[model samples]
Target chain A: MQGVNLKLDEIRKAVIEMDDVKTAQLVNTALKQGLAPQDILNNCLIPGMKEVGELFTRKEYYVPEVLLASEAFYAGFNIVSPLIKSQSTEKKTKVIIGVVKGDIHDIGKNIVKVLIEASGYDIMDLGKDVSTERFIKAVTIEKPAVLAMSSLMTTTLVHMEEVIKELIKKKMRRNIKVIVGGAPVNEEFANRIGADGYAEDAMQAVKLIKKITIG
Target chain B: MNILTIKKHGTFKVKKSTKLIDCLAKNGIPIIATCGGKGRCGSCRVRIITPQKPPAERETLFIPQSALKQGYRLACQHKITHDMTIDIPRLKKVKFTRLNANYGLALDIGTTVIKGAAVNLKTGSAEKISSVYNLQNSIGGDVLTRVGASIDGKYDILSKLLYSSLKQLKNCLGIQKPAITIIVGNPVMLSFYLHEPVNGFAQYPFTSNLNKGIFLKNPPRYVFPIIGGFVGGDTISGILQSRMHKSGKNSLYIDLGTNGEVVLIRGKNIYAASTAAGPAFEGIGVTCGSLALPGAIDRVSYAKGALRFHTIDNKTPIGLCASGLIDLLSILLERSILKDNGRLKYAVPISSRICISQNDIRKLQLAIGAIHSGIKILLHHAKTAPKNIDEVVITGEFGSRLDVNALVKIGLIPKGTKKVSFNKDLPLQGAVMAIKNNNIFHQVETIREHSIHIDLAAQPNFQEVFVASLKLAPWN
Candidate 1:
């Protein structure tokens, strides 16, 4: 408590190490000491995940490691989310992602979400096997900056375009930047299906969304 | 209406504009359609000796222009219009174990292929073996894709197709019905045989009613116990075959088939995980891959800048089979043609007819990554590393033939692998084991309760490990 700045460093270190138990314990300790939630999130959880992503890109850490670190990030995020709501409110970038209707493969999508959240994005994960109506409804309600869809089967890849057309029918296509990816999807397929961008992997998903959002 | 005729095979009458995939499936010979004949994978290709119309646009995109010119077209994409001659080229190879008693059948129902061995109960040895491409593949090459195929009410047809394929395998042994039939497969394949719902596996917390084996009337059949949704009865059989629970040394048994299943043992504790390796090892999704048949390249070697290879039966190299695919990847790695990140310096031609594409390398990477990550996770959960393991047992018809060096170079096997063993058809072997001793069936139930099943998909670090393992080099 005396060294609040140093304690924040320790929290970041725990997240990087993917010590979820330690992360939860430290978050409670920092809050009991009356540390600011926003500061903790910005200085601890976010930086911790950023380092996890960097380690991942450098080939030092793999999916299992990042997944554990993401859990650690969430452990801190769960504690700080409610507390930060009462403090200063800053606008967060909103995104919606799900495996399209009839496809439940979400391993790649989940990784993309974790990496994106680490990069400081508010992700509304619709989860896998999401219905087109649910996707349309989420777009209308969440009005996210991007709507990402994924599928592992080539048969279900058509549903991604179906959602795109449904978006156009409901006048939501222009409102959201659509991105699609999975095993069977390629840039040409993305272009053919009217997606704004296509990401090949989890790391690319984050970069693709940032390019689309910033541009 | 038109008639489709094969020069030497036979003649089949077809409806006007009906899909060639459906036409073939209806005639009891479904060709390779990994994407369920949607014309997406371009696997169900056939030679059109006579054509009435031009090829589809996607055909040009998928097939080489020369092949397209020579009348090679995706059967799924080509529709029957006029009477034409077509050729479906594939070699049929089946092993005859040895014949003794009245027929007893043991089946290993794989996602991509269904292999059955006729057992002679009197001698406790396999009599004759026959395998067929699992017709459920028209549904998909993987369980999840098959789940998607079931959405269109084709699940019943899938079951029926499987029944017919099983009969065909049985008939090859000149047996009408085995006195007893024991079927073993992963959850998805077994569930299809059991007529369980496939859609349940595609949703959250993915559940399946595939737990425990069930007996059927009339035929005296037994479906093996499924440990978990994805773990299936196949892993249970692997455990029984390897006797991992009783082994003093830490042992790892891996079945490198369509859906890669891994089992780890540390004393009395057993851990299992299934990773969707995407049929890469079975030679399903690769560019020039074929099942191990006559004329299919099964091995490759390069020394002093000389490239040489051998076929399955020492025949001419028509296509690369499973072992050849792995060896090809290994040779490319050894020669620096393939980079650690799974990119090729350029397209490498293995033959005038067979060229290794960059896409093929990526597919292998994904397959290896899936399997390698699953192994790493199961080992991690056991709180152990690869070095601590005393034995590595690879089970599968394909894995049995793999060069140990290829696995080590590709990083599929741990660098510290000390005792490596080959288990040909581990699930089938277990099924045969259970058939010989019905008491072992009870042991499977015990095996299920004692082991821990890890859903690699749900594992937190699966993605990280998978991505890291995507490197085409050995793990340091």
Candidate 2:
């Protein structure tokens, strides 16, 4: 048990250090030592990512560092995720995400997508510059529990409201919790656009989605 | 009844509750409101010479308390409640007589700065060279930001700002509406100047409305033709100045500024790509970054385990400009104070107010990554290696001030290139050349006909290449 605890600590440290190769090697070693994949994931990888999120919020880590840490987290995650017994897919809540039309800045959206996936949620990424019709089509088809919209430019911020209006017009607003984010987005603007939630960063985004979905 | 009087300019009859900015514009006063009179940019600041109105909530955010105390207020935030007199600072008129009838004005509208040259059409020699900050910068510091602003229905405001800047440049050069004017800039800037919608640049399959040379009747101005996507008239101007299109040797031309446009010439093929390097190279987004002006640190050296630096005019160090940022990064990497992954070990203070932070290094890394990856991808598309390139031409605002060794040390330019040269204001030079010889337009059209634009974002391996290039190390 003590040896298992030490191995989990090493995996967490490797993630913080953004050492993808060391992380994959350590995860493989733990798996060969007869450790449960779920236990390794719950105890080591998620917690490592949680710390990374905290560091990002504190400004100690930036986009490049966060991206690298996410890479390291996935390096271990890919080796362990398939080995875990499949959960009931029906119980999982799906989130549809996209950058609004006229805005191609997706680095923030990509980060949020990774963090939310790491937290074990279903994500439907609609890439960038997605039109309003496409968002309505996805919401109508996917019937997602949450719709996440991002725009890095002030000009494109109006598209988020347009999506919300279209959702209301299609009578899909109540079925999905709409959340908006990006550099130009604020809680006031989100409220004005009738979005259910707003997140300042990726960590807040994941947490906001979790809270809105579970409630 | 209310009367609004400008100190030097004429007074105007105004109604109560009219926005000061709108009143000024209606009265033919050229005031810069980069945020379109939204009380955001503070560019339209005026000094109240009459009864001082308390600063508005937005004014407090942008104006310093001392300035406010001295009767300065944002024009957008002020309304004509009563009779008022104010002073506008930037409307000072310069006194200069027209020198000659055969003079031509050449203008390069950059995202950050607008440069102009007064040329003797007969001799093709520049009579005067001057530059001013692009007033649209107060809307946003980058091309995309301004494009977004234009998309948000601020096109008229942006166009007005461009004209005001041009008017200022004309005044500085002492040329009052030369017989013929030549304009060269990026696609977005040219579009803004023509009041054309920039919605095409807001998304993919980036189409430009100004792909051919246009002549305006009222102003007698000739706007240069753009290539494609973000590779606008400036790159065409650069090619014209370098004559790389006609050369047999493989040559790379890079215009490094807010937008890093790379053009590779091999045989008859001309390939170009525009990388959105942001304003990091211009020192807009960094913590202690500034434009290359007096008091701006433009060079740095590490010797005897200490860092030494020099400003543009041997003045107090205000902040790091592009060249200084590159030199400082090279010195930091040499001392291992900054990691290859762009993490700074600690903040290195150049002065009491200015320091190189970890965030600054990351900004530089992103910028360098964009340019380096752009060059690599262009080379990959051309089926040529960096070593095979015969000449590399670097041009932009930094020009001769940039240290070639430091740029190479920081891995911005490819390692072991055959020859490297720096040309100052190639776009301006090309515009002047066009004015001197009207037949150059035919050559420009030929070059445009042979050019191909590659969308860097659309490339499959762009993310991987960009990430790999982010390391502050020499090319392999």
Candidate 3:
């Protein structure tokens, strides 16, 4: 327990350096020593991702780096997830992400999912060609912090409204924050459909989520 | 009596002597009057249970003389007379590739935007797309400007820009080398890519070596031949993918890009024409018009004589682009904010949002007029009318975003037309096909040969139609 701070530093270096095996080891050791899961997430994982996100925003990193870092983050997460659940510690946040219905496009949505998960949030990855009902169901079941919807086609962008309509029908829209992204999507489109937020890029999604949840 | 009412959908007027085609065209009703509304195509024919005038020369030329005697008339050829009813069967809608096997790459070389995509051959679907400003953008924003640049002997820079762009796209896709690549672009894009002089498209004889596909050593792929300078390979690819050839049903495929390409298919006969739609649809040349890029207000409201705009970025006020231009123009027409002369009602005190100037209206008039003239030429040659046009297939990513009702209101698309919107990432789709399917690669050869090329400038009536269509009310 006295070595908690030392383990946290090692966890930070492992995530920053994108060393998944070492990061996972440090995270497991810290959790075994009775360090708070939230502290490890906020102080180590969050800071590490913030640096990675900055690299992405500045174009220092691309889709590959973000994806690899996410893999490392998940490796560490698998070990702590069982402990936190057993101890009944409150989870940070859960999220549902998908490319909207009729839009089978996925590169953009996949990028955003990796970034969000790397930020210490649990993700329900709905994948592409997502139905509105499925989104609503996932939101109700997971009670995620945000619903991130992506669409690359203008013709299919209308389906985003269907997601919201389904949410209103289920009376669960008020309980979840909805953020939309994609090439054709813009803030106007987001506002038009009454989404809580709109991110033009994967990095922007991270920053906006922080603003929304932390605020 | 109910039939006599005409049940006009939007703002079309029917007259006793109004030729069915002219009436439909005037109302902005979408009639795929490819063949320039000529009866020669039989595409403009409508069943007239209602007594109507005898067939015109163009209709008689296409439909058998005996069939014409039986009371069938080209909608462009005959006019409605009595108050009786008639049946206008819906034309078969053009279907695009939906399956992954059909997906292919598409490279759209627009006057303003250079778009690229990766398509699937098995289903003819598209993905892995990217778009950026045509680096030749620095040369000029419109084809005419670029043509002028070519005329000035600065075509090399334009060609270099395009070549590098393709290279950049290839690199981005991680395609070290694709075995086969399909390219769809306007005549300018193709010509520039080939490093050929573009002056032919600017004047008559309007012919180029582009009717046949070409091979480039640099890209090392088979480049699809453009049907014409204006129409380009994108529309050709679209026409081919639409299967307009298979149904033997008279169909017209119009790809409204910087240059508008219109094709007419009647039975096995195919005729293609080009219209200098310019960059009007992209919002260039219009006073307040711009491309549908960021900061452009795509929709505006002038309810109760006040203005509100919804921009693309949802940010602070920005200039209007093509999507916004159509939206604003339609809203203005609906509210009578502009006079019939295409002049803004000056008395209303133009809103700050309406940056549209007197000059901009003239440009819109010219651009719209060019589109109208192209349709008329197709009708004139095909001997068809607007009403006879069964289906109007307008392709383009921009076309999907534009409100059909608004487009017709502003005389962009014909009125009362049933428009089927296809996700037009054609250049990318064509590329994807080129990469995977060897059969499609061969098909491109046949498409080049079978594609009937109509020189818009050489067509005798182009000047007259272009002039006539230039007016605010082209119908009269």
Candidate 4:
């Protein structure tokens, strides 16, 4: 495949115009060449997903736009993922995300998952109503880089510490970077529970994960 | 002389009854009889063992013949003539105390106010209810302001303020301790109550860690399930107490407060969501708009092109009530004093007969538009329309007295929908129910499970409709 100069304007057009086919085609063309997956991801996928996240956060785009952009991002991710050398998997990190037990809310968790995954990270989504033991077991088995716990209830948030404590009990606390998010879990609460970091949003989660790993 | 006995459940003793109505009335019984106990409600019927004179017209008209044959006599009509035994059926003696008792602790955690009541459960009523402005008002008056406050190190203040308010309410009610505490509030309020972070509700996948149930080791040992934020505990309480869930027809329960929560119950399912209608209905931002309290103008009537209003105190003119605000908007629109698009017809020579202003129309438009847009989203999510709606049960202070016709004419509530109404204290009723039976927690969970929560933020057309609705001036 001959190299195509994937300029900023071209990538921005793919995102702003919401042309999934064009975005995927350009990313695939770049990947098929000697261009790095990391470059394509940072220049195209991250920025495109960031636009979707920002538009959603600012109330500019609604659910349909966000959903469509995420799908488009997924199309681009599929193209770049295979070309990334198997050794590059070590460069990326695994993160486990779930809504706490007794909380069946997943919309926020799902959005965060989408944004995080689009950021070139592997996610272990435990889904909603995830018990502390399940989180502990996942921590022990997969040993993900970051354990992202989410909850929508003020009442169910107390369960986050239990999961954190269980991780410590299993001697997996230092090995795992625990990130807590959701409507009720604040930075202070995260600090109180001894979590590694607290991301206010999905985009923030990506930044925090990047800082913890790449730094 | 006839003897009648009033007993609890199964056991009773014979007592001389000279005049049953007088005795029952003196005893503070609430018997439903419109004709002053002339047996209109058949609510005062009692069984008699001794044969008496033929049934009276009042008795025959209201009470069934079968019941009459089974010794049914109107308590008001029955008088002692000879020594006779009277059987007081469970229906007659179903003592209903003032609904204050059951709530024992009624907490109305409004964005601006936190009012509560400590009721007696045994009497199926409310008792010493207390109300106070929420201390969180100091941090911010609205949910967004509060959210901002939460984001900026003011979360503790909200928690402490509400806790202090609840404590004070308990003290005022002389409640030693509320056995089962039920909190009914907006999502923000609920989040603040449990000290959960609420900033997430302001963004995507909006929700908070709302406890489905709590088994507290504290004084109020049993913690009930929280309804949900946005369409939080208050609306959940409204649905439970109003029995809107049980209604056979397609119904909508709109609790118009700072956060207007709309619930559409059809068959076995509930479609619930909330629109940030702001504090317009509660008179927070509206000039001359006040709550449905004493001296507030709650109703408006137009006669001969003149707009007249009826106040809560039945006194001289006060500020406009929530309903009156909507009516005023509707009247302005109808008389061509305001445009259908919610603009004032300033060119027309308007006299003292009626007054309409541009600002008034804008205020009305915002309030009514929020409500209208909310209904549209709810209906759309439910895959139904206003025509499919069999009834609209309007709750809350603003909802109770809303002019249904005006609501339709101004396109607030849809037309042809039968408007069912309830007083502003339905949340109190629900709190009472929750405190009385632990089962209410499970009931709320079931209701929550059956409910389809539609996030207005997620609705693509919400902003478009909201902006479109804002064009209409003060919702008359």
Winning candidate number (lDDT): 2
Tens digits of lDDT, candidate 3, B1-476: 11232233332335676667656544333343323343323545556665666666766655556556666666766655645444443232222222223334567666655676665555555556666545564444456555655666767766776666566555554444443466677777778876777867543345567877776665455677877546677776776667666666667677766567777776565678776565666654343554455667767666765777787767655457666666667776667766444656542323464466545665576677767777777767778776666666767545226676766676655666644454555445555556656677566666666667776655655545665565444141
Best-matching candidate per TM-score:
2
Stretch of 10 with least lDDT, candidate 3 chain B: B92-101
Estimate the overall C-alpha local distance difference test score of candidate 3: 0.64
Per-model CA lDDT versus the true structure: 0.79, 0.82, 0.64, 0.67
Comparing to the true complex, what docking class would candidate 4 get?
incorrect
Worst 10 residues of 1 chain B by lDDT: B91-100
Q: Better model by DockQ, 1 or 2?
A: 2
Runs with alpha carbons beyond 4 Å of true place in candidate 1 = A1-95, A100-138, A153-181, A184-215, B6-13, B61-66, B91-101
- Per-residue lDDT of B1-476 in model 4, one digit per residue for the tens? 23444544232222455566555443333332222342323445567777687888867865556778897887777766655555555232212223333345667687655677666767645766666655454443456555755666767765776677566556666665565666777777777777778877654456677746555557563334555556777777888888878777789888777577888887887888776665667654444556666767777778986667777768554456688777777777788877675546562222222233454455556667778777877777778878888777777676236776777778777767755564677776787777777677777877777888887655656555565554443221
* Candidate 2 lDDT by residue in tens digits, B374-409: 999999999999899999999875612677777787
Stretches of model 4 off by over 4 angstroms after superposition: A1-215, B1-103, B221-229, B346-356, B467-476
RMSD in angstroms, all models?
A: 8.5, 4.3, 25.6, 22.6
lDDT of 1 by residue, A64-171 (tens): 567778899999999998877777577778999999876656767888888888777889999877989999988888899999899986657778999999999988
Per-candidate DockQ versus the true complex? 0.13, 0.39, 0.00, 0.01
